[model samples]
Each structure stands twice: as C-alpha cells, then as structure tokens.
Target: MITDPVNRFIEALHCFPALPRVFNPWFSVDPEHDASSLAPTHRIDNLSRYLTERLGRAKVILIAEAPGYQGCHFSGIPMTSERILLGQLTHKGIYPGDVLSGEVTRCSRTDGPVGRRGAKEPTATVVWQAIKTAGLDPRECVLWNAFAFHPFDTDMLTNRKPSSDELRDGLPMLHQLLELFPDAQRVAIGKVSKGILDKLDIPTSAELRHPANGGITAFRTGFAEYVGRL
Candidate 1:
C-alpha cells in the first residue's frame, strides 16, 4: 500500500493509457528517451515534492482545464515551466532548492524532430504572474489541472481542447486528488475545468477566467477578488 499521496497520485496517473507520458524529476533519465538528451525528470520530481509540501499548508486549490504542450508537458508540474524548474523566476514562497536538487538539462524528444528547448510557456507565465499580482502565497494554494495530460492536435505542437471522453477517463484521478485535500476549497480556472467539476457534482468556491487568449485581465481581477475574500 502506498502511503504517500504524491506517490499514489503519480501511480494512478500512470495507469491511464490515454494520459500522455507523465514526467517526474526523481529519475536521472527520461524513460521515453534513448540516451541522447538529459531528462528533466529530476526537475519534475523536485517540483512535485514542492507541490506536496505546499499542499500540506494549502487552504485552496486552483484547477485549470489541462496541461499545455509548452507547459506541464515538459516540466511535469502544472502551471510551471522550465524557467520555474531552473529557478529563473523569483517568486515569493517558491525557491529553487526546494524544487530542484542539482543540475539537470532539459529533456528533448529523441524520436521526433527536436522542438524548442527551454521556452517559457505563455500560459504558465500568466498564471504565475496572476498569482503574484494577487498577493497570494504559493504555500496557501495548490495548482492542478482537470486533465493532467497535454492534449495536442495532429501537429503535435498545437494544443486542443480535451475531448469529453478524455475528461471522463481523467475523472478518477481528479477524484483521488480531491480526496487528498478534502478540506481545501476548490477554484476552477476556466469553464472547461468548472464544467468537469459540475459533472462530478463538486461545488467550487470560486471560478476565474483562464489567463489565455486575451483573458489575462479578467483572470487577474477574478483571482485577486477571490483571494481577497479568503
């Protein structure tokens, strides 16, 4: 029996065939890659551990639609990217040493054409910026996704909305995640996330606009308002 919530969550994530490869930072190498590129696995593990630590003190959870190709797809941590993994961004309540242990290069795909490396994800930037702008402590909140995996189009680069079937398949993991934080209030970040919660018959304390496609202002305002009430 797995005693750790983080370990159990990761294990449950692995059980979903429809879920894309979930990366963690503990391993030195990417299991999906041959020997060509150094894996970002360690960075992912560090972030996961950091998240778990934060969850222990969290009063609320912000749930988004899903991970994007340029964000969690590479970092393995939702609402985070390589910049956060490498300790480039200095935000209150987030330290490099807490999430990253040692030096590790970012991972790349050895099987297909190489994509951009170390690129900052726009949505991730916006989300973190909003968090900081709202004066919310990272330790007081947990960030997650309704669908944990990146849903990409045929191009394998462009993001697409997660299908209903995909959301259905991911519901069990979401349920398990909620179980880990029974006392924390849930805040849906977008309509997609809110819809899923509604389907699950879960009541959310608040809802915020997603910080994408020109919704940054609304996202910041809504988030700040919600945090103010907390």
Candidate 2:
C-alpha cells in the first residue's frame, strides 16, 4: 500500500484513462523507442522523490499548458528535462539540486537520435531561467501543467495543444496538487492555463507568457514583474 500522499499522487497518474495519441509517462512506454520495459517504473520513482522533497515547502505553483514530448513525456516531471534532472544542465543554481531530488533516470533510449545525453527541452531551460531571473528559489516553486500527460495528434514526438476535453480530464489530478499545497500561490504560465483557472474560479496571482514558441523575453518580463509584486 502506498502510504505517502506524494506517492499516492504519483500513483494516481496511472489511473487516468488511456487516450488515443496521448502518452502517460508514468504508465505508458513506447515499444519502439523507450529505454526498457521498466522505463515507466523508473519515471514513477523519479517523480515520487521530486514531489516528496517539496510537498509542504512550495510557496508557488506554476501551471502551464501541458507536458511536451521533449520534457515530462520522458522525465515524469512537469516542465523538466532528463538532461536537467541528470545534472547535465544548469543556470543560476536551478535544477540539479533545488528542483530535483534523488535519482532521475532517462526513460528514453540513449542510443536514439536524441543522442546518449538524452533529450533536452528548450522550454524547460527557459522556464528555469525565468525563475532565476525573478530572483526566486527554484525550490519554492512547483512546476505543473493543465494536462499532465503528453498529447500528440499524429506523432508522439511532436507537441500539440490539449483539447478542452483533455483539460477537463486532467482536473482531478490538478486539484489534487493544489490540495497538497493549499497555501501556495497559483501562477498560470500561458493563456490556456489562465483561461482554465479563471473559468474554474481558482484565484491566480499571476499569468505569464509561456516560454515556448518565441515568448521567452515576454515570459521573463512577466515573471520578474510577478516576483516584484510579491
């Protein structure tokens, strides 16, 4: 039996209904491309440790749109990449130590075209950089997404926006996280997240541009402003 609330939350991800073209990193493994049959289990362990470390300490929660193929789809941690988890990337003291705790293994094969170092997501780097730019401790913020799973239209490797139905489907887990950090201020990382948070009447402290699709500069500015207001 899972005793830890964080572990139970990690396990709850496996309960999400299997959707076509959607990938659940904690439950599903790509037969043709993943590292091994145990990749999903490894991801589950990694995320469990991450949330366990930050449970009641997070002061802010950053809600983004959804997990991208290059990020959480393999790492099992939202807005984080395997390379960053593995201590291969760093900037201004984020990641490696503050963002992730315990061991993090790559769910994707090292021999693939992404190379032996594993995939790195630019969005992950930019988001962490924004936190540092805002002069906030990375550990004080929890990175999440409206849709926790990776949704793709045709290719599992390519990222696509989650539909309204998908967003609604993800609410139970989203609410679960909020409950786990009841006092943390919610910050939407893009229009989609802000729209959903607004519609649900969930009070949000700030809404910043998503650091993807060429919005890094704007996101940094908004993040800094949000921190300044704190």
Note the clash tally of each candidate: 4, 0
Q: What TM-score does candidate 1 reach?
A: 0.80
Worst 10 residues of 1 by lDDT: 21-30
Question: What's the TM-score of each model vs. the native?
Answer: 0.80, 0.92
Q: Write the per-residue lDDT of candidate 2 for residues 119-206, one digit (tens) a residue.
A: 7898888888788778887767899987889998777788888887887878898898888788889999888889988876678888
For candidate 2, the lDDT comes to 0.82
- The positional error of residue 171 in candidate 2, measured at the CA in angstroms, is 1.0
What are the clashing pairs of model 2?
none
